[model samples]
Target: MSALDGLLLERVRGLWETVSGVPVTFPPPGSPAAIVTAPGSGLCPPAWVGIVSLGRSALVTAPDAAVARTLRQALSSVPDDALTCPDTVRSVLPVAEVLGPATLAYVTEGTFRPVPDEGDVEHLSVDDPAVSAFLEAAGPTDAEESGLAEVTSPVFVLRTRSGPPLLAAAGYRRWPCRTAHLCVLTAPERRGQGLARRVASAAVAHALTAGLLPQWRARPAASRRVARALGFREVGSQLSVRPELAHRPTGVTEGT
Candidate 1:
């Protein structure tokens, strides 16, 4: 790997270590599949499990040691690159529901190439009523999926000088590791117009200027495309699972 790639990998490992509240170690590239465990971690909701795969190595976080042990044994023989596959995860944790296989992409100042700001792009408080209305117009599913409401940073918007106003909006939530988790959304009608790219560019630039690593966790192809356009590198993936055992009667056991 290039020196830059090595640096980026270190940053990612550090971020996961903080998020998982445990040591995270990666095997050398092309090494046999390997995983590290973080028990009783806050990587996911209580009773849920989270897995992050960075090529030949992965980190698995579970609510408790018992669950972590079960996962470790179950996934022991799986290839590292297949660790994030939903089907593989589901087969091993059959009673659990999988949440994602989101592409975890990141961009550093050296890699970031901001899109040219077009039209009138403005920075506004995340709580601004205009932002709310825009999210509402984007529909419940899209709005919730965008996660714009969770942004702790200023929101960037591209709006129409005339007509229906908000065309697209973007922002980031500051993570504990100084990672900026990006959220971007474009009005359904305005999607193909490059508005998402414009607003997202502004948000990314802000994050970089603040000395934060910009992270893009994208599930949609279009969103991934926007991240790639801004020079974000897809270096890994993340998935969360919640096992049905978590909801069983207190006296119930796994063998039961």
Candidate 2:
């Protein structure tokens, strides 16, 4: 399936490596890492205890006694903002979404395709000016900035081609062995237009063309509406948390 680009996914994998003092060893061939979000289980390797919190998680690739000792020490010495020790992770539970074969389709009407934003708006790809405007609107947070890269991030935006270009930003994580998780943004004034939906389609289309699946992971009700319009049916939801906002986990990570 189509997943995050080469660069953006490194940012995610790198976060765990940097904070946990362990290597993120991806599985080879037919069997890949399972999407681990829950407390008791996930897509973990035979010996690895894979923990994934909203903002941070501790991954121990080795499951032996020595590895367990290493993990304990790693946790103890980790800073308050460490991937597993962060305040936001403690408040939420594991993720739960309905699983199905990747079959998400596009909205059938003439409205949701990758049409340009319009005279005062332009719907361009990642390198286009419209996407640039959208990122400015998103205002990258502290951790996001730490991991941000121009070409690696799965960042996309919508820019109004009007006076003094404005934007809106959105983003998502790349699930291993699946598709490029989408993140989107747009100018506040650009709300209500189907431009967001269109931008999402464009991103998914890119993933599909690459022989990868584009998954719509987490989002709010408004954003979910866009997904519905784009032909994605809800199968399940995960317990989502924002360590960045409150320094601890607080909500359910929704999905499906």
Candidate No. with top lDDT: 1
Q: Number of clashing pairs, model 1? A: 0
- The most accurate candidate by TM-score is 1
lDDT of 1 at 72: 66
After best superposition, candidate 1 residue 256: deviation in angstroms? 20
- How does each model score on TM-score? 0.89, 0.42
lDDT per residue as tens, model 1, 145-254:
99999999999998787864788999999997789999999989888778888899999999999999999998889999999999999999988888666544344333
Alpha carbon lDDT of each predicted model: 0.81, 0.41
Regions of model 1 farther than 4 Å from truth: 27-42, 246-256
Q: After superposition on all CA atoms, how large is the RMSD of candidate 1?
A: 3.4
